[model samples]
Target: MQKGGPPPGRSSTTRRASPRCSAGTSRLRRVCQLRGLASAVGSCSSPASKRPCRGRPESLACRRHGRSSVDGRHRGCMEPPATVGHVLALYPLDRPRAVGAFDASTRNDNLRVVDAGGRQFVLRRYRRNRDPERVRFQVRFQRHLEAYRFPSASAVEARTADPVVVDEEGFPWTLFEFVDGEHFDFSRPEQAREAGRRLAEFHDVADRFVGAATASLLEDDVRRFVATPRAVVDELRDAFGIPSLELELQNFRRRLETIAASLHPERLDALPAGWLHNDYHGRNMLFRDDAMVALLDFDKLERGPRASDIVRGVLSFARERRGSRVLRPVFARGFLAGYRERRGISAEELAAMPALAELAFAPYAAICRMLQADHQDPVAHILGDLQGMRETEAQCAALRQILV
Candidate 1:
C-alpha cells in the first residue's frame, strides 16, 4: 500500500521525457518508446493485426486527452508509463498525478497516494488469467466483504461502472482505494495476533459466499503434479540444459511422493470447506501501529479446507529461525488460539496440518519447473523449500504437540 517508488531493480527516481503535444497517430507510439518497449504500438494500431510488444496490448498507452471526462487528462511527468497512468485515470480523479510501481510479486501495480484533487488509489494490472469467471467471482467476493465493513482493500469500479477493464492487448486491470497503514511486521507477536484475529473474521464472513470461481483443491493439486513420472523431470532437465540438477530433482520427487503417499486425500477433501483468502501472509496484510488495518490480495481466494489456509498462513507468517523451516511455536499458538476464538479446528484438521503443509511443495516445485519455460531461475525458491520438506518430519512431531 506504500506509494511513489519504483519496484526493486528499477530506478527509484524518475524524470519525465519531453511531452508530446502532436495530434498525429505516429506520435501515439512515443509513450511506448518512452517506456523503452521498442515494439510497442499505439491506439491507432491493432494488436490482433500485428504481434504485440512482448505480447502486451498497445492500448496500454495513455491518451494525452482522454476519450471521456471521467477518464481524466493525463498531465505531467510520472515515473511509470502512459498505460499505467491512463489506467489510474480510469477511476475518477483530478489531474497533476505522480505514479510508480509498488512492492508486488505476482502482478503489475501502480500506487498513487494523491491525485490532483488529493484522492488516493492503487491501480493494479492483474496477471493475465484465461478465466473471466474467476475474476468476476473475486470481484463479487471482495464487494461482499466490503459491505460487511471488513478491514480489507476492495476493488473500485472503473469510470464505466465495470469492476474490471480489459486493456487493448486483453489483460484485466482494476483500481483500489488506497489503504493507509504499514504492512504487517512478522517479528512482532502482537501484530501476528492481530493478523490471526482478522483472518478468523475473514473466514467467518467468507463462509456465506456463493460464486462460480473454480479452483483446484490443494490435495488434488499435489496429486496432479506429484504423479509426474521421474522421466519427466529428467526430460525437463535435459531440455533446459540443466542435466546436473536431475539427481537432486529426482531425490526431491521421491521424498515428495513418499510424503504424498501418507496423506488422506479423501479425508482432506471431506474436512469442512469454506472460502479462503488462499494467500494470507504478513505482506498481504496491512497494519497501523501494531494493529492490522487491512488484508490485501484476494486474487487467489478459493473454497478449501479452513485448516489448509491456517497452515499456509503459518508457513508464510511464522518465523523459521536457525535455517530450520519449522513453524515457530509462539506464532502457531497465537494464530491457532485466535482462530479457535471464532470456530473450532477439529482433531482431524489439526492432525493433517503437518503432512498437508509438507505435501504443498509438490505443486510449488512443479510450477517453478514450469517457469523455466520463461528462462527464470527457480532454484533460489525451490532449493530451500525442497530442503525444508526433507527436514520437516522431526519438526512435525514437535509442531503437533504445540498445535493440538
Candidate 2:
C-alpha cells in the first residue's frame, strides 16, 4: 500500500445507513472544504450505534468497470447521503465525516475524502467512459509507474486485490493516496520547464513499458488521425447539410484538408514513437513550488510518437488564460529547454512539429456539440478553430526559430 493510504482489508465496522442530506453532493463539498470543522458534519455510525448518518445514498462516481455486483447499490442519480454505506462499506477505511471534490478535480469521478483519523484519500470513480479492458490496461501501467516511483495518482487496491470496485450500479471505482499539490501556475516559466522535464521522465518510463508494442500503438494513432477528419466532415455534412453552412466552413474544411495533407500516414508512421499522456495540459497536472507533483487524468493515455504529446504540451503550457493564445517563444522555449535536460529529440521530430500544429489544435468539443444537431447552423461551431489560425501559424514559426 502507498504510505498514509487507507488499509486494504475489509472493515469490521458494519455498514451503517444514513438519511439523504437535502443538499446532497454540495453539502459534502461544503463541509469537507474545511478540515477543522469535519467533526461538525453528520456522520454514519457503526452498526453498534443506531444513529442514521446525515446524507443521501448517492452513486459513488468511480472509474467503474461494471464487472462486479449491482446488488444493494444506489441507482438513478447520485444521492450522496449513504457515505458510510457506499464508500466505507465498499472499502476498509475508517468512517469519513465528509466527502468532497479533490483540488481542481471538477469531474464527478474524483473526490477528496477525510476520515475521522485525519487520513486523506481520493475516491476516483469511472462514472463515465468505463471500458473495463481500457481500465485494466491503465491500471497495469499505473502499477508499473508506482514500481518506478513516478509521481502519479495511482489507485490503491481493495481487499479483493483488485483496484477497481464495481458498486451496486456496476460502476468501477478506485481509491488513491491523496497527493498534495496544486495546478501549474502558467506565469512561471520554470514550472512549464519543470513540467517538460517531468514529461521527459514520464516518457522514459512509458518507453520501457511499451517496448516491443510501440509499432502497434503508432499504427493505432495513424488509423485515428487518418479517419477523424473524414468522420468529422461526414458527421457534419450528413447531419447539418454542409453546403448550406456559411463561408467559415469552406475555409475550415480547406484548412483541415491542408493539415491532413501535411501529415501523410507514411511520413507520420515513420516518426519516432512513445507512450503519450494524450492530454498533458496544465489542468491535468498538479505542482508545488514550481515542481510537478502529480500528473492526473490518464483517461486518454495512449502510445504514439513523442511529438503528439510534446507539441500539445508546449501549446498548453504557453496558452494565455484570457484569450486562449499561446505566449509564443518564451514559454515554448522554457518547456523544450527543460525537456532537453532529460531527453534528446531528433531534428526530424522538431521539423514535423510545424506541420503537426493544426492537427494538435483539435476541435473535439466543438465537433461534439455540433453533432447534437440542435443548432440551425450546427457547422458554425468550428469557426472557433479558425480564430486562432494566424496565432497558430505564428507559434509554429516561433517554434522553428526557438531551438536555434
Candidate 3:
C-alpha cells in the first residue's frame, strides 16, 4: 500500500455527501460561517470551530463507517478484526462495547472505541507503511506533553515495554485517551487567546524535551509549496470541473512563488527552530466554550521554524472564520497577548511570519488529499479542499503591520 493511501486493490466507491455541506455545488466552496454552527471541513467541527474547504461530493470531515454508511455496514475502513484484543492487551480499558470508524482521516485510520464502561477512546490504527520507530517517538513525545499537563490527546501506554501494540497483522496501533470537545472556535477572542497561550506553553515544554526528533516536514516542500500549484493549475481545473478556478489559483500561485523566493530556505533557517506541532490548526484541535480542551493529531511532529507554525495557526483561524482570509486585528492581538504571557515572538520573528506564512499555509495550495489517501470516488471528494487564501496573500503588508 502506498503511504497516505488505500490498498491498491480495493476499488473506491462513492459515498453519500453530508447534508451540512451538500447545500449546493456553489455552496460547497462557501466557508462555514464562523458564528454559526456549521463547519468548513465537512461536519467534523464544533460551534466554536470552523474549517476552510473548497468543494466536494462529500464533506472532508465525515463519519467514515457506521449505520451512517451507505448500507448501514462497516465498509471501506481499516479497523482490525481483533480491535477488542488490541485494546485489552495494550491499555487499561474495559472490554469494548463497540468500535467504529471515527473521522475521515487518510493517513493513520482513527477508530472511536467505546468500552463496556461507556467511556470513549481513539485507536490510531497504523497503515501498512507505518514505521514503528516514528510512531514510538511520537507516542513518547505525547507522554512528555502529558507530564507537563499540556492539553494533548494523552497516549495510553501498553502493558509491555513498547509504547505501541502490534496487531496480529503486524501493523502497530496507539490508543489515545478520547477527547470529546468542539473544534476550535475562531469567532471567540478568548478562545483564540487561549489557543495562543496553549501553543506558547507547548513550545516552552518542547524546548526541554530530549529526543531524536524527525526531520522538518517542510525541508523539501518549500519549493513545491510555491511552484506545484501553478504547474498543476490547468490539470486540476479540468479534473475538478471548476471552470473559473484556474485563474484564481494561477494568481495565488504566482504570488506564493514571489514570497517564497524572497524567503528562501537559508533565510528561513536563520530563524529559531523548535519542536513544532507541524499540523497545528483548528481542524486538529478540540474546544469547549472558550477553552481549548485538547490538541490532537501529532503525526506531523517535527523540528522547524517556530514562527512558521505560529503564523499558520493565526492565519488558519482567520481563514476559517467566515472565509475572511484577511487577518483580523482582534484575532492577532488576542492570540499574541495569550502567547506572550508564556513565550514571546520577537519583533524579528513576527516580521518574518508574513512570508513564512505564504510558504506554510496549506489551504492556499489547494490540497486534494482524497486523490492520494482517501478511498472515496475521485469526483466525490477530489475537490474537497481547493479553498484558496489569495486575499491573505494580498494583505500581507497589513498583516505584517498588525503582527509588528
Candidate 4:
C-alpha cells in the first residue's frame, strides 16, 4: 500500500515487440500485413457483402482475391481474431461458461468464469509489461503455498513457463482455480473473529518459509517511496488542492523514517525469511459456510517481514468502520490465538503494532489517492471512505480508552 515508485524491472507500459514472421509464410503474418484475402475484399466490398464473410475462408478470399488454391484451413489460423473472451470460451475445462467480466484495481485483467460443470474460476491476465522479477517471485510463491498446503487457490495454467500467457495482442494471462466463498463483512463481530483467526494461521505458517534468499517486499516499497515522497506529495497537492493532506503525508514519511531507523539491525538479520503474501486483505480472502476457506491473489508475494503479512490483515479489516464498532480487540484476540497456537507473538512484537499498522496503511492511502486522481467518480469513493474511516477512528478511540 506504500506510495512506492513504479514496480521494479520495466515499467508496465513497455511492450515487447512481436517476433517477425517471414512475409507470406504464415496466415497470421498475412493478416498482420493486411495482405490476406480478407483485406483485399474489405477494401472494395460493400457492407452488405460483409455479411457472408464471417469465417476464415471468406476472410482469406477477401485478402488473397486471386489465389484460389490458398487453403484457409491451417492450424492456429481461424477466420476471426481470437480475443480474451474467445480464448476463455475455448477453455477446455469442464466449468460453466463465463457470463460476465469484472475489473479490479490492479494491472491484471480479471474475468469471472462459470464452467460447463457449474464450477467457477477467475481468469487473470497480467499486464505484458510487468516486472520479470516480480512475476518470477509470484510464481515461486504459488509453488511454495502449494507445497505448504496453504488454503489458497491453485494456479490452473499459465500462458508461458514464466507464469504469463501472452495473447496474440501481447497481453499476459493466467488462470486460477476459483475459490467459491464470500469476502468477510467486517460489520459482524463473528466475521471479524474468524478473519483474525485465519490471518494468524496464515502468518504463522508463512513465517516459517521466510528465508534469507527471498527479496523483501516491504523494504522494496518503503525504499522506493521514501526516496521520492516529495514528488508524490507534490502531485497529490496539485490534484487534491489539500495542503493539510500534503502535510499529513510529510508527517507520515517522517514517521516511516523513524520506524526504519528504530528497526534493529540484529532483529531484521535474525528474523526468519520466506514467501509472504504481500497483499493479504479481506478482499483477497474467500469464505464458505462461515469459515475462511481460500486466499487468492499471490501476485504481490515476496520476501519480507513475516509480521508484514499479518499487518496487512490488521490494517485492511480493522482500519475503518461506518456504523459498526471497532472490532480490533476481537480480531486481535482471535488472530493471536490462532497465531500463538502455532508461533506465539512476544510482548515486544505487540508493542510494535501501532507503527506497523501505520506503515501498512500509508501506502494504501497513497494508492487510493493516485487512483482517485486518475479515474472518474474517484472523489465520491474517496469521500465515502473518508467518512467511514472517521467513524472507525471514533470507535477505535473509545475502545482504546476502555482497554487502557
Which candidate do you rate higher for lDDT, 1 or 2? Answer: 2
- Number of the top candidate by TM-score? 1
Model 3, 255-370: lDDT tens digits are: 65676676655666678888888777776788878887788777678777789778877776655474467677888778878888998788778877887775554332133432
Whole-model lDDT values for every prediction: 0.58, 0.59, 0.59, 0.47
TM-score of 3: 0.66
Q: RMSD of each candidate?
A: 8.3, 8.9, 12.0, 13.1
- Arranged by TM-score, best first: 1, 2, 3, 4
Task: Give, for candidate 1, the lowest lDDT window spanning 10 residues.
Answer: 70-79
Clashing pairs in 1: 57-169, 60-83
Overlapping backbone residue pairs in candidate 3 total 1
lDDT of 4 by residue, 1-404 (tens): 11111222322221122233111123322333332122211111123342222222332332222333233322112222224444554455763343333334244445555666777776665542234455555655666666777677666654334444555644445566776667766655556556666656666566666433334222245333344545544554565646445555565456545555655444443444445666766667777656777776665665655655654555556544523435566654555455555665555555444444444434433444434433323334434444543444445444333223
Better of 1 and 4 by lDDT: 1
Tens-place lDDT per residue, model 1, 126-231, is: 5433244556667788888878888777777778887777665445676778888776565777776777777888988887776576652222343333445354
What ranges in model 3 sit over 4 Å off? 1-76, 80-92, 99-101, 104-106, 127-129, 168-170, 215-257, 320-326, 362-391
TM for every model, in the order presented, reads 0.74, 0.72, 0.66, 0.59
Model 4 misplacement above 4 A:
1-82, 89-91, 94-97, 102-107, 127-129, 158-163, 187-190, 207-220, 223-249, 257-274, 319-328, 364-404
**Clash count of each predicted structure:** 2, 23, 1, 22
The per-residue C-alpha lDDT of model 1 at residue 157 equals: 75
